[model samples]
Target: MRSRSTLLDGRCTISRCLPLSLYRARTTRPLENHHGQTPVRKRLNSDMPASTVSSRHFYQNETLLDFVARSSRPVSLRQLAFFGMKLTNDKIIQSANFVRQELPTRMAHRIHDMQSLPYSIVRNNHISYVYELYYHSFNTIRRFPVIKTVDDNDRFCDVLRELLAHHTAVIPHLVMGVIECSDLIDSKRMDNFMESMLRSRISRRVFTEQHIALTDAFLKDPNFKPTEQVGQVFFQCSAADVVRQCDTLARSLTQSSHEGIPIPELVFEGDVNTKFACVASHLRYMVGEILRNTFEASAERYQAMGNPPAPVLVTIIDAPQHVTFRFSDRAGGIPPEIIPYLWSFVKGPRSMIRHHNFKQVPVLEAIVEELETFVAVARGQRKRISSLTSLTTRSPTLRLGMGLPMCKIYAEFWGGKIAVKSIEGFGCDVFLHISKLGNESRFVQMNNI
Candidate 1:
């Protein structure tokens, strides 16, 4: 009998053991032993405990089409809150079951989408890595037993957290993969694939986090209030405050990188006190990216001219149903050559080359930590640190070329849009439109692929 370590090593080294063509071919076809009997191909994770490994089986009994057909409909912010209100033990169990059923379906759809990509593109190492991660996550979520008690819910939450953390490298890897395979796939097809994957990722996170939050709240308090925010979404999120917070963080990042250079002032105008119901973190990220770009550009222009930086004008328009923020900068406009590929994730020639050459791709957690740390310091939650020095070491300018594209994703997640208009030799204007109704369903794609 083989030792457990030997089995794990074999599983881990299987791809390397076979020729590339044989490995690729075997992924879609089964192998036959000397007796002409097909061997069972179980998807095992060496990282998981032996107990977990023993209980799980490869997804041989299910089909990708079946999982996609079983996927549940997306819920809106209002619906999420409504479900959380009057939370009970039964509700907690229901939430757990919902997540168990939903996550795997979403992951299956993404895996199918990747499988549909050009053969050369899908075969790239980075892309294959992402596919394996999704495949494993799907199997992990789908194999859980039915949730019956609070203890079961707790264990499920742990699984959700683990999977979420494990996926932090997904975006960076996907970016690298797409860049390397740019020649094999068309730009529009790549964008569609990426956008669908990202949107589905957001939807999964929302559902997973919401259930986890509900379980935690129920456990912590003897009387859990339905009105309390049990998830990432905030009901009375202040748009003005979010803008100010992002503005400060972005300015700090810009000021830290450009020492001895004058920093631009941000002048806020119109509807300064508008409050709405939405995800504050998403809003902060979008605003932070826009401000970071504007501030950095403005500072550089002024530093080159040996003059004070021009103030960036931010005008907020609060309507009955939506809120729009317009950013006007005077540093310099985007070059004509770069405008066409501004929102592209796979087409930046220089950035793509840099990404391709990277030994280790940046994870989403590190980026979030940098932004959160600055925001915490600005809010007096943590001791002050050297913003410039910290940012310089942590996140470099345009390191992955993901900010604008990701910002657009977060905005559109809740029915928002980001638009950029640049004038040659002049500054640029960006308009960010966010839905304030909180009733728009999440932008999740189903059978459309």
Candidate 2:
């Protein structure tokens, strides 16, 4: 192998004793031979292990950061130097540029495309870029002398905004999309007529299909007796089961809705159900909203591509230590510019804010009529419209900006926290963490839905 200098602790020196395997690794660039195949370059890290890549867990529990982290694996200096030289390959560089350009185009062609352009690459690319950036940041940028400035804070904010626009937006979207998708799939829509429809449902087939005892509990307990006495109900949903269901639904929907877009990848650690083991109706609604946004976003991307909806992956970690969830997507990741204000209802990209999906409606008259009705309602309470009835009739559009905030509130209320991360041109990840139920197991538990 040819001799070369290696950078160690910010210093460089020629070293001949460096491992030859490292040189061989460098010679190949990306160490393709180590695994006997071209390493997959992932754009995002779904909340599962990379070894568990599957279309079933496509978007449910993935994040762009995980992809970045996985991509940043340590390698020998010879490999790094060789890879750096290989990066000069027109084809390698072109592939990167191709992603940068094609992603934005795909995004712009769809609503909220700006948010999904980043998380498309496979894992290796994500890590490589992160590693390269780390090297550059330390060896190049850090070497510059620092100077204090009165406007430093403001400057930082600008940089932060820029970074978010360029890096973090998709992370949360991936997270939000995954958890929400799983939860939504797990949700069984029970309408007002459900009771009347199921009144005669005590067939032997039903008994054989489900846990009869659990069914009896729901039928007997006033809390879930399908009566008016139940103000609001709560339940626990299994994360793994939810992932399985979402996969089924996404596949069904994709086959029926659009042509066929490839689904995103998903990966995660631990368990999802153990976090939100017990769930409330409000939390379900919140989860629905988040999933609705995710689905809508994915659907829009599919439409833009003139392809069908793709598969999605959702993971719920029912870990004993911390119950968590991961959501990932194949539509790349969110744009960096919108990360800070992603859930803030602040103005989005001008193109999105001005693009009215309901453009055909007469806005002026509609607003005036809406305001007049609002004032009329505010002046007095109506006796006829029950709160529940009104809630159903007046439910806000699922795409409204309230989803994340509502999810945060519900997650926090349930003794958990939510977080997100993304890669600029790859994908995104969202994580929800809740206090674990110490020594608790739902293995034999049955949900009396």
Candidate 3:
């Protein structure tokens, strides 16, 4: 039995105040705010039973449960392009409706997952902010009327545009929350939560951006012809070309960061003209991150050893069902200490260092490109550029240790994979396998929560 003063004091932590089981019990009272007032609760949907509501988590609502009960519709590259080719008013409305219904489902699952986290983690200010953001977005989207007319769709798009902008800060805030709660949760649990959150986020963005692109295309020209690209999906994305472009950008960025350091040359090999059907921006980010790592490592190694930097070998292999990009670097391979946690988002010895540095730029404006830039391109102001190029231009040395994990997520999103083979004292090889079939569905791991 804790005293009122003890419970309301800011010095008391959730875990310190109550046992985990009791904290999670349905009968637990809602936590009081600094003003010692119970938060106002929304009216539960008439269909929902009182037993289903938990006072411990205020955001658990009927809309969230309804959406969470439904499964998400997955789209492939071919399916996405096929729908966008001959867009009409009806098709636009159909697309708008899909987005309207799908977004809330995805957001609901995320919020549910957040609610399922430990009470101590949920109490984190950053995590609480994210939870509120999702809840707000989820409610706002679910309340929107079904799209029937073009005017309705226009209004829906406006809402999406605003939500998308608001979500630009989600990644950074989530990262900070995890960092702050690192001691409260195990590495595996944190990784699983972050992975599920990010993958779902990617899926949501894909659906939203694709529909927006389709609407913009139809508005620009009623008789618009679909070429290689239909929104984010590219029917014949050039792998070798993306590599060369990323190489150039990575070299320039590395040189800028490590001034006067000898940067390694990228030696292209194998199929240099390989083309495939995939999302070009996702591929660009993976390749650019790999190239940047190799270049920076090679430069540092050579400079320290008083020797010239060695060239990096990039081999592109195009198979019948898949495309593979292999990046071989001679720079001293990944340090053995951090290799085990290479693909972890919140683990490893450098996590604290990364946390300290990330605090300097608390809010990451964008993961790939700013929303303004993406919207500008959609509005036909400028041609679309590589995501990595845009990101590096904004922050050349933006290394928060999320590159590899994010790359892995992007690869797995489309049923592809990323792997690394490292020799502690010699060199390393990074393999990026992409599904060329364009029929494989998005890879969504089940949330343990």
Candidate 4:
């Protein structure tokens, strides 16, 4: 295989005539542990082993940095490398600060003064750029040999840290399109903004799924060696089981905080067909976040009324290409006034910013000294990354407010989406669509040709 120095010499356009051998090397599915239970399924438990891939990396290794760097647009490698590392680390940190500046602050004005672009041209160009990134990130990583020494492994991680960092940093670039909308409530403006944001998310999901699978493939490759053995056996995963785990977490969380508050009952409906190839951690995080909101809202309502909490119902549906989870809560549908801000990355009135209680958050580092996880787990061994709502991964209270939006990202990033509908004065129904991992990934139809 050609080295990156040789391969990335030219503009790596989506139309470039890349070799077939490279594609084959990068895209092959590694051997999977098909412990045949026919749609194998397992319930999530504390003993559930940490998800080797998804928990550690939100964006996959082969993604956009390399493509954008090699795009016709000029960029200095030194600077590009810095941008790359920043993006990945920012995401792992899920820095509330970056999200504030990049999305919300940018949107505040755009929500009032945004304009439209040449619709087809802008969207398509964005898609074209996305394809270019996906192609380069995946193919480039496939060419590396396994690390055989401690120094090589460290070097590999260091180099990978920078490369994946750049890929990650470029993700919020999708915010650029969304910020083009000024009138968040105007039908046309909303449509365009929603279209841009959703498609950008979909594009992200497509590449992310590629990253998840491809990274797993590489880690599982016999030629690969690392400081530790990340298991190669891919466990069959289940949505119903994950819901149960999240529900359990919700109960524990509510009990701790809302002391006298009734434990909001969480019921999970099982799937007739219960198995899929999936990243268990992502599903767990999304489920945990959604339920956390439900439980918190329910407890808060009761705390206000001096009444008991109502139950939240969870239903799971399994299909060939996807798994759907429905979380229904009776906490009085989100105040109609708050609906508009539902998806935007906004700073809410709550800040549970407790430092050092969890794993030591890296002191915001410079590029030269910077390093790497879905891991806010140093929040230590048992830690879960902060959800869409919580900034510190250690906080189980879910108050910092990135929750639903981040859940939507996690859900959709895998070709799944989370949608919510509320009945004024009554309740809310949230449907989480998880595109089960399998063959419908990457634009094999376009890119492979």
Best by TM-score: 3
Rank ordering of all candidates by TM-score, starting from the highest? 3, 1, 4, 2
Q: Once superposed on the true structure, which residue ranges of model 1 sit more than 4 Å away at CA?
A: 1-62, 226-228, 353-360, 365-370, 373-393, 438-449
- What lDDT does the true structure give each of the candidates? 0.67, 0.32, 0.72, 0.43
Candidate 3's C-alpha runs over 4 A off are 1-60, 362-394, 439-449
The TM-score measured for candidate 4 stands at 0.48
Output the better candidate (1/3) by TM-score.
3
Model 4 CA lDDT for position 347: 20
TM-score of each: 0.80, 0.34, 0.82, 0.48
lDDT of 3 by residue, 1-449 (tens): 66535533433444345433444535545444343423223221112222222233444355567888988776666667688878889999999998898888888889888767765576677777777667667867877877899988987776787666566557777888798887777879889999898888887877787888788888889788888888777888899888887787677677767889888888889998988877777787888888888987888797779678778899999887779999998898999999988998787888887777666553453343432243344345674543222321234565688888989988887778999999976789999998765434333332211
Ranking by lDDT: 3, 1, 4, 2
Q: Which digits, one per residue and each the tens of the lDDT, describe model 4 over residues 11-96?
A: 23211223343333223343323321111112111122212111221132233233323312111212211222322322222322
Q: By summed lDDT, which 10 consecutive residues of candidate 2 come out lowest?
A: 196-205
- Per lDDT, the best of the predicted structures is 3
Model 1 per-residue lDDT tens digits across residues 1-449: 33435433323222222223332212344354443323213332322331221122222224556786665666677667677777788888988998888888888888767655644455567777777778678767776778898888887787777677667667877888788767665778888788888878877777777787777777888477645354666777777787788777887777666766777777889998887777566677788888888888887788677667678898999886678999998878987887888888878656655585443444553233456565456456763432111231244344556778888887787777899999987899999988875434333222222
Tens-digit per-residue lDDT, 1-449, candidate 2 = 33323222212211222234332312223333232322222212222332221121223222222222231121121221122222222323332232222222221212111112222211223222322322222222112223133232223223222322222222222223322222222112211111111111111111111212222333345243322111122234455554444443333333333345444333434544342334333334443444444555565666666555444456666555566667765555667876764643223443233223222111211011222232235446443421111111111221334356445544554356677676764455667665433222222111111
lDDT of 2: 0.32
Question: Local error of candidate 1 at 307, Å?
Answer: 2.4
Model 1 steric clash pairs: 256-388
State each model's C-alpha RMSD to the native. 8.9, 26.0, 7.8, 17.8
